[model samples]
Target: MKQPHKLWLRSLLIAAAVSVLTIVLNTLNVFEIFENKTYDLRMANSAKYKLPCDEICLVCVDQESIDWAKENYNWSWPWPREAYARIIDFISAGNPKSLAFDILYTEPSVYGTEDDTALGDAEARSKKVIQTFFISENDYDEPLFPVEQIKENAAILGNITSKKDSDDVIRRARLNYEYNGTVYPALGLAPICLTEESIDYDSIPVLEDGTVLLRFTKSIDDYLPYSAKDIFESYEAWKNGEEGPLSPEDFEDLYVFTAYYAPGLFDICSTPISQVYPGVGIHMTNLDNYLTGTYIKKIPGYVNIIWLVVLALFAALIVALSETCFTRYAAVAIPAGLSGGLVLSIAVPVILFNFGYWILLIAPLSAFIISSLVNIIFSLGAEGKQKRFIRSAFSQCLSKDVVNQIIDDSSSFTLGGKKFEMSAIFTDIQKFSAFSELLSAGELGCFLNFYLTKMSDIIIDEKGTIDKYEGDAIVALVGAPLKMYDHAKHACAAAVKMKKAELELNKDIVNYASNPKPSWMEDELYSAFKILVANNKTIFTRIGINSGEMIAGYFGSEKKKNYTMMGNNVNLASRLEGVNKQYHTNGILISQATRNLLDDDFVVRSLDKVRVVNINTPVQLYEVLDEKSCAKEELIAYASDWEKAMSFFTSRDYQSAKIALSELLKKNPSDGVAEYYIHLLDDYFLKGTYPQEKDNEGVAFNTEDGVFKLLQK
Candidate 1:
């Protein structure tokens, strides 16, 4: 198959693998516990916008009620069933829609059978009252029902039994419970079942385990609790025809759920809103959800798996397609895909929660993350292998910057050319041929390698690309594969540093005789070294730098290509390296074009304008003396005085120029440029070569075929 098709197939395979893994984990309930926690967090965050259910309220049997009972009626912990009867009668007076007891009365009242009958009688009179029943297990063949006395007198019996998740949080309620073939509605659902005839029971969303996810709209604290003792007291006040703190109108048309709120009752459990939530609040939340049609509907496992597969495939395709493109695109697409997928993974489920649906977040999120990571790892492995190959193949032939550029974008390796304003450096060792002939081939090779390595290191350090080496000359270019705006500055800096390094290398050579010679040293090599030492001469390098528009790219045959620069400016740089011999100036020189691009970081003295061979345009030249930071005071003073002398000579003021040159030579007798100019003035007087009339144009010389030609105007 084609590469694109193969990549697409690979991405599909990765998506499939991730989806299947997540599905298996989902089936095994691996993410169930954590998924439940995320669901709770969504519920809690969503609760901030949900208003509390005003239609449903709690009548709590709190400690105050218990203490009041003890003080008023001398009742202990278990109040008489008659007390509950009185409370029921008081609530029924207001004609509430329904009243459900969260408290379970599965056993007969401890006071007597008549006490149970009294409570049951009050429930019968109320006619809207609902009692609770409990079952330890759901799959029991036979389950014990509530006591006969209470069961027969109550209006309806709801299963108050609820289950907690693994995290011990009650987030779902079993709306219906089956016992020995009889299906009973939950206590929270019993009131809704009796009152709301319009609700389709089958339409209610439920999990496979037959439980409805309860969307808690409010906390237990949101409910204003009505004390049982206070209700009893209100009942007495109504009987005496006097005003009371609470009236029958308070409970009118409201669903009153009564349960224990006292901490000692141990009826609190962990809920999404609070760790210690009243158990009775769960039933109230269930009723609130059902009444408002806001109960959370869990999305089916199949639907979740579909979403997971889609998201995983999306992530996989993003990585695969990006990898198929240039590596630069892959670098951006991978992170964007990972972050975008993660955000979507989280947002989908939370958004669904607002619409009363609970889509599984972990399965889809895990699929996206795992699939993206796997594809990214594979892509990196492939790219890494390709990069290693490229680096190995070209690291020695090209600069590190060029090799890296090719690695990042392989198109750079192709044979192409583009013109850019850049700098080129041509370096040659002075008198290298003479010294090389005196040593063996091995000794010559060692010396050249050492010198080339030191200079090459400085070039690379300054971000210059080594073009090639011709015998003992180094040709390099700056700002090609990687464009730098300060190419001229960097090229000049490399030249300066190379000069400094050469001085250090010469010192090493001068001190070589002091150290013990190697056992393998040849007598001829030692003799040549002694000759150099006797003459007090060290190897010097000449560097020429020029900056202009040059065509830089890979050139040569298709089979064997080389990256180099070619233009008139490149020729000029080579010509300037040889120009150092004309005036016997220092080792470094630059063209006027190059000098224009340089900052004040370097100190250079102006040389005469010269027309190089094969180039008709006369270009002015400057000799680089030393970096300003390291240039000696005498050298700075000499350069300044030399500039004044050149200015006088350029204006045809021969007398002033001769006097200035003489004075400069006296100060620094060994200054070759000053002595050369002094001799030039004497030669000009003898030959009458001086210009007859003053001209704005300076004295121009020609280096025709590597020989200097004196100019006469």
Candidate 2:
């Protein structure tokens, strides 16, 4: 199959896997418990609500109040009903907004009819006083109101049953419950109804199940509290004209909740804010929420489903995009994907919360996390495949550094072309056909393999890309698949090294043929081959280098592919290698384009300017003499005189140019560059008109283009 189709299929599979996992997790409702915990965390992190600290109060029958009452009034457990009657009368004088009793009075007082009469009379004088009742589900199914004597005098009766979650935490409350065809409001609902008598029942916000998510205004510690005995004691003190420890005026205009808070009392319940909270405090907060309309309305089930789908798709999209585009940068993208997904997971819910929408935090967070992991796994697998392919393709020819670059970013090594600036190196065995004629096919193969392996190693050591080998020639590229700023220098360096390696290989061949035969050589006829090598029947190669923008990528038929480079720039490098024969020069030849990018460390001499076959303009070429193979003093002197001769030749000074070349040829008798220049001078001198050396306008010595325009191949 085509590579593009395969990539798309992989991406689709990754998206599908993530989507399925998210759907399965959501279906199982596994994230609900985690979501609840996150809700608690957000609530804990949130700023406390600005509840009216003085608006509502809890008058507790705490142990402190019990002890105070016991010491002063000889009251112990089951105190007389007159004790509650005196406390009620004290608070009633202040005309509080609303008062609710969380304590139950299931039966008449055990003291007597007089004690019952006293408590009932105290209730009659109070305004907006509510008594707690139970909604019994027994066979009778009735509202279990307070005793008949106290019920007739009470202003209102409310159900006090608090609904608990499966976790045993009271997070929500029912607005009302029905018994015997009559709807009884909760202990909190009575105060709201009493305060907003003009509001319609249908106008209030309530769930379809007649419930609401309770909005906790404050912690249990923030609730205002007064002792039961303090109220009665303070009222007595004020009536006697002395300063009171507490007074009825303290309860004026506040919605008060009265309940038992002794440690042994069976009224503490777990809430989101506290593990052990007094039920009276819960009622107090509920009533305050109602009065201020702070009740939270939960989103409907349909909205939750849609939200889950949207979040899942969002997570899947991120995974797919990250996998397809950023596969090369897995090291960077993996962590970024994880962190970005996690941030959005948290931020989305928190943002919605500010707008009064409480989204499921953990479920969406799980979707993001699970999706990211799936994509990262797929990406890692794809990256591993790419690295393996790169190792297979380039490991034999390139250095570890170059190979590592491909491993680090496999996307750069895709099966397609990319245009980038690079340097090309081409090398060919001089007179290869003649050499092949002298050896058997197997001998030729062994020799070629040895020669090619040595030259390829030199190129790779300098970080060049080996494009291919054509019979007796090798083509290589630099600055491709991975960028290298000094590609020209590396190409030039490799060419010089290859020339040196060729000499070493020649020595090794001669040494091998002269000494005892190595164990690897199974042929007894190999001794006969040694005679040809010792006679200086050696191999020579010429190298060419050029630098420019070229196209490098995979090339071949459907069943095969080879990573190679191709362009006009590459052709010029090949031409330069062939141009060496015209001047009898060997070693390395480089175009002016390559020479211009080199540092001063290289020893190079200008050869000539010639237009090769199929190219329009003349190109300046240079011979890169191996300094490591030559005497330093001789190389320096030769380069200096050669530059002077070329300058004189281009300036139309034939005599001076001939003098310089003749002197240079005397010092280095085998200098091809000097021989070629002197031959040019000889040809011009014999033509008698000094060759005119002009353009079509007959201008003298027009060497502005600095090219010789070779007439011979």
Number of the top-ranking candidate, with lDDT as the measure: 1
lDDT of 2 by residue, 51-149 (tens): 644688888887767778889889766677788777787787777877788888876676777887887888888856788897753557656688887
Tell me the TM-score of each prediction against the true structure.
0.51, 0.50
On residues 1-713, what C-alpha lDDT tens digit does candidate 1 reach at each position?
22777777888998999899989988998767557657777888788777767889889888778889999999987788888888789899999988888876756777888999898889889988888877765365445566787688777778877678875678899887877677788888888766776346676776788788888865776765798878988999988888788998899999998888763363656787775587788788878877777788878768888899999998888777676764465555555656677678888888888777889876787788678656655554577775764465346545799778866775454344689889999998886756665666766666677679999999999999999887679999998877888998889889989988988988877776556666776554555556567666687898999999998876532223467777778878987887776677768889898899888877888977766654667778898877788888888888898899889977667789999999988887878878877776786643556422122122343223322332211
What is the lDDT for 484 in model 2?
86
- Relative to the true structure, candidate 1 reaches a TM of 0.51
Query: Which candidate should be chosen as best, given TM-score against the real structure?
Result: 1
